[model samples]
Target: MDLQLKDLKGIGPQMLHILRNNGIWKPYDLLLNIPKSYEDFSITSIEKWHHKETITCLGHITSELKLIRGYKKDRVHFQAKIYNHTIDIIVFGRNYLIKEFKKNDCVLIKGTYDLYKNSIVASTISRQDKQIEIKPHYRIEGIHDLKLTHIMKDLFESQTLPIYENLPKELLDERKLMSRREAFYQLHLPQTFEAIDEAKRRLKYEEAFFMHLNMKKDEKIETRAPKPYDIHQVRALIEKIPYTLTLDQKEAVNDIFRDFKKPFTFERLIQGDVGSGKTMVALLAAYAIVTAKEQVAVMAPTELLARQHYQYFKTYLKDVNIALLTRKTKDKDMMKHMIFSHQYDIVIGTHALIEEDVLFKQLGLVVIDEQHKFGVSTREKLIEKGKHKDVLYLTATPIPRTLAMLTYGYAKISLMKEKPKRREAILTKYITKQTIDDMYSMMHSALIRKEHIFLVVPAITSDKVTDNIETVYQEIIQEFPHAPIFMLHGKLSSDDQDRMMENFITTPGSILLSTTMIEVGIDIPTATLIGIYAAENFGLAQLHQLRGRVGRGNLASFCYLISTKEDVERLDMLVQSDDGFKLAEFDLIERGPGDFIGHLQSGYLDFKYLDILEDEEIFLTAKEDLEKIMNQPDFNSNPKYRYLYKTYTKQT
Candidate 1:
């Protein structure tokens, strides 16, 4: 709607100032607002109302009234009959209400009831019969409950002005969901709490429906015919590995193979936990595709990760002609020329690989590590640079299957549930104050074993005493006087970070202090202990990832969750289970989807009013319904679809 808050009636200069500051420029912006909470201001009987609680009562003021005029003000005493009980009312210094209180006048008295005095300390006496209110509270800084409602009520009353009709009556009827206008109305000015909840649900459903539509990417689509390759060759590569592949990793490899047999372009996601072997799966797939006379582009989100992948590729397949293309790589033109001329079999790099000048010859498979970080558009651009033979995504963050299906609609998924046999499951514990000395003792023992330590703080520097990189570094240096101590965070230069990481990896009995920025894809197999000082500041998935840096080797590992806050459910959940997928679901449900979505897919899923966790059922229903409808041949011409489609286009 073109209806701005400026056009709405009863919004004077003060209201306009508040509205503009809060980003509510238009009528629909108000629709996007969600009430913080609701309060009950309904009229109640004397017996039902509690002491010191503000309640409203509809009662008749008796003819008998006493007025005591003091020097400064006047005190009025009166009797009101409510629910057949005679309750005394004392109105002090509110002389203006005296005129409104007439004999036998049925007035609404709002005040706190006193049980012992058997009277109400009246604040307001109104002749109007006040209806019961389930007050919807919006916490705008300068706007009170009444002022906010006045603006909302005015917008609702302006019926000729418009809000976008997002869904059709047929869809509403099919789902038994409230109409957009009705949902907005009830949500702003609720009739009953049940109706308010229903309104919230339907609004979330509509937003999620639009979100799914936004993420849909089939506008320019084509598939490739599968090129046959020798299965025995890929198997021999697998058998040549020093250790047997985990069952889940083997199955993931097989899933990629099956996708290769298909006639369509391959879009698959290899999901696993922190120590799970997703990279190995990608390596195998890349080898298979490159051996079939096609090049593979293995992309990582960061330069460090890309370099790590290139080193792994070289270590495993020494004969493979792999090129590393990055911003820091020397001779950019030469690298680009080599890549364009197909002089290399496999190319690994950061987003620098997607520059227009860098082209791949017979690019068959695109393997993206931490795929969520690249998003769909960057991924599509990379695929456009290739032959579109197949694409594989690797991620450590695990989404539930239902959520995965709803989110990555077109991409098939294979999960790596098992870590390697040599890697022991990390023993998790909640660090207590009493265990402080024991922790240092364990560190001393780990020092004897030549293992390193990871001290993860919540920040680079902090106002707090100890839970930061700088302070923790100082403390650790004091404890281990001769040991090598290194620090890493985002503020440091990338080259400095690489140097620090090298020192950390090579130096034995070392301690590295860092922030959550280290949670990406750091492989420190010799590190046996990771202690998160402010454990409560991190989520379940993140905690799992930080703990993953250790326990990568055969030696035992421990994750110390240390925090001042006791009995944190998320922290406890971390200690109880090691599975990343279950922790992701728990974090989504308990803490809300904001952090989870923000960490991975930041810009793509910009939801204004929907809480994906709370509205999961509604979202899934919307997903299923929209999926079926969009598959129809004439869905584009449908009125609701067209309306929303136009609105979405305008927004873009």
Candidate 2:
């Protein structure tokens, strides 16, 4: 039943608008608008009431409800007698209750009891005409709890719920799950807690099953043969490198080389912790492709990062012709000409590389740096530049192993956990605003050692003229009196940012006050001290990435996380552990999967009831069942499976 809200009785235009705003336009949306919480209205006596405990009591109004203007707002107060006890009923900002209640009127008061005030803060006062078993509360704005509950009751009694079932009967029976119809009914009108739990379990399973099916459908197994790489030339270049490759790096390189040898397009994700030399591995892969006379394109999220990659590639691959394409590149026509004519063997740039004017000459490999920054659609558009080209995703944010397996099970994964031999673990500390003097002392000592500092703020400017880059710069300058301070932010022009970064890199003891723009790509080896303002505002992965900037060089580095908030539990996790993977897991647990991986990637999951961390068993079960269904001979012919696939595809 794909019924519109207008078709339902008692739903007016204003109610329809409010429902639509809350993502409920159709009957199905109404059915899916499950309760946020349930209130047990089993009436209790006022004698048993405790402070701050939500309870329901059946009482009669002994005194007239009077509306009095309080100091801040209007309040309705009345005395209600309940089972040998008289309790005050207080309704703040709700004056309508005065007109709704009368003396000696029998009513049910549901709210929290305030023992100190000897009053019960009434959330809802309704006439005690019918018995209420359990009350389901919704979060719809501009609507009362009783009104929404009444609407839900009407919807359920009308039996207009959509009867579309996307789960196979055999699987439902095997799992002993409730029917979709019964589950929906029990979720909103559960008679017992067991029924609610069973309904939630079925709903979670269905959500996971659909998510897995959607992921499986999007995965494309490449069948076309890829351009082969010249193994000897790749090895020669690796041998000529000045530094030795870590064991993990060597293994990653080997995995990519092996992937290239397969008679299909290679799709792989390379996860490395910050300062793990992932760029070197990417460069080697590009070299392997370039030696085979095929062009490679490396895309970074920002122009600064793209330029960094271009320069790094140019330095290492002296014989290879590389071109950088960005929005700011003045010689765009020349670069486009070189790219189209195959004069450049490798092209490095930001999203500008995927523009219509840019065309590749035998594009064989695509390397996406900070891959999480781009959405799947953007990646797909880039890959469409070349037919069945090998794609490599490089990210410094280490994903938990189980999460990676569940999310990117279709692609091959290579992890680079070890940092370079010369790199030192950053000394991380948590400091409060009161400890600014100590931080200043530490900064002075670092500056005395000829080390530059990075002062990262959450914002570039503030109307209040405090806790921003400008304020921080002024404060630092006043503290040192002779220190040079530079500022960088996203609002700055590309050339200005590059110039400021270059100046910071070349100048010793200089302080660069900037935003998270410097979180990923700017590499200043001499910058040994970093002060992050409002550090609690940043994610654990992001904090880790920022700390990575300081510890790149052999000189011991320090990171000071300055936060004003007392709840530093998440920030404290970063201080205790240096392992990016462990931090990522902690972050995943602290924040849900959607926030941890970011909205773009998490949109692919689109799970309504299933959480990757909490519902691991449900996800595993769905994965196993999906694998079995995929291997079945009559999978496509199954109606329930087809319905589920169609439902997800349509939604996407």
Candidate 3:
């Protein structure tokens, strides 16, 4: 049999199961499990040993080894005399070591030295001849260190590693990169630090290179027949709005129009901060499609957001036949027939819009709100419902310019950085737990003025509670006994959630306690105050989104970040600025690209080593290399590139 992981000498059935659980089912997988860190086992003099530092000392066990019985177990203790110093050695779990070592026996002891006890807690004791120059430390769980080291050593000495060189020869030569076999060997067992560093660089480049290739494959430019639309009708709809369009909004609308004029199907991303009128841009695009006699579908991630868009569309496009389709729609069959029969010019809904049976009459434009919340496959499924429909992705979570260039490099992008002319800037403040009484007093004043409030928490129930909704809900109701307070969370039934939201919207001076479910979609103009509990627990982008729930109207709005003094430095960034794009850049820098873009979208990229935020140079280099490679005539025909493409596709 081929030497698989199970073929290893000590790997029994239970051991094989544990190895597979850590993604090491094959020998190659085990080889790829590079060391998380390394320990230098070079012998050090006892006089040079530092406290809390792991060191190996060549010494003689001058005193007799004794087994000391403690409350837990027998501990083997001995005193070692080294060059000018006497060091005590203690072994906690190895009583047999007492008989293994005798007085005046020279041995090598490796462990961490303690200053308080003037002793070393021995992790491993070996003959001086077996001392190593450097030891690699792995991150595998539920495995003995010595056993893993022995297995790895055996594999390295006996087995031949799989050699798969994917990079072009010229590029490899120019970059001075090592071949795949050499890189793997050096990564697992390097003679010097330079070798390990070079190996890491090669691996990081491969990660970035493959990621770019996968993204390029997914971003194939399609040549779809253009659908002619009247530009004057779109302009007329824009003019009908009560407020004039900002320059950014006008530019964004013009960009969409330009995209519609192209012969290819448009894939565009429209990003705007809160209250920046992204809905207006979407509405204008819908109007253009409707004017062209083509149907439009706008999908939001949640029902509340879908309803919000439905209301906005109905208010603006009164003559256009628009309908809402959701999981809870009263007449599902009728709604499906109406959508399929072209009874509606525009349809807006949640994921229900992408159902296999929810066919579109003619889906010309597909607008996805909070696009990061949904996976790429979900977006593709909805667009597939239409025949080469132009996709307009709407995101309130502002992305940094660098990130947008790298992640959405293949797509047309438009920005709505400017807010409406009348929208007021929200005042953000960071307060501590002691200041709650004062904040409640202010809330009472706001309530008396007929303004609604939102208390956002991190969790729903008190069991797994950190910034819990139930706890805050009880406190708020007790503080203001006569005030109408309601609780909303993901655990609640859809009907109950909708009722709570409706009640909060219809009732003035109402307080609603909710989780971050209200972070994106639902908007109430009367919601003048937002108190976020454990604000430091939220990302800046999320806090920005929660703050956006208010300040939708001309009313003066306030967002209180309830946190401790320790979190002041981080939360101060939110208090100082309202620009979502700026905050997004900061968030990216502070929390990394995965946390900023969210897991759903980041999982699509699936980069192993390159960080989109920190490894910009590597990413750019890889992109350039990919572009050069794609220009080659044999790029697609090459077996290496094909393999990489196939592997990435399967993983994603």
Best by lDDT: 2
Highest-TM-score candidate: 1
Full candidate order by lDDT, most accurate first: 2, 3, 1
Candidate 1 residue-wise lDDT, 1-652, digit = tens: 4666777777778888888899887777877786889876577765678877787888898856678798987888899988888999988897666665677988878888898898998886666444646767899887777667777777778685576567867778898889888888898888899998888778887887777676554323357778576777888888889999999998998898888887777678888988888888899998888778889998899888898899989999888899998879999998888887888999999998888988887898889898888867788788888756587888888876645655555577898878788888889888864565667777888888889998888988878635788777777778788877889899999899888988888899888888887787888778898888878787787888888888988888988888867756668888889888888898777666665656454343456666555566777787688778778787768665787556445544
Each prediction's TM-score versus the true structure = 0.79, 0.76, 0.75
Over 1-652, each residue of candidate 2 has an lDDT whose tens digit, in order, gives 4578898877899999999999887878878888898878878765677899998888889998899998999889899988767899988898887777799999988989988887898887888568776777787779776777677778888887556667888889989999998898887877777888899999999887877777776676677675577888988998899889999999999999888888888778898988888999999999999988899999999887888888889999999999989888888998898898999999999999889889987989999998878877788788889876899989888886547755555567899989888887788889987998888998888888889899899888877435788777777778888887889998988889888988887888888899988888877778898999988778888899899889877889899999888857788888888889989888878777778876436434555776667777887787788788778886667666786556545644
Span of ten consecutive residues with least summed lDDT in model 1: 213-222
Ranking by TM-score: 1, 2, 3
lDDT of 3 by residue, 1-652 (tens): 5668878767888879988898888888887788888776777775777889887888889899989989987789999987757989998889888778899888888888998898999897876556656667786778765567777777777765456788767767888888877887776766777788888888888887776777776675678777788888877777788989999999998899888888988788898888898998999989999988899999998888899999999999999999999988898999899999999999999999889999988889999998878877888789899886888888887886547755554667898889887988899988988888868987999899999999999887666445697678778878999999988998899989988999989999989999988888777888899999988778998899999999889999899999754888889999999988888888888887666666534423565555666677877787788788678787667775686546545754
Worst 10 residues of 3 by lDDT: 599-608
Query: Between which residue pairs do clashes occur in model 3?
Result: none
- Per-model C-alpha lDDT, please? 0.80, 0.84, 0.83
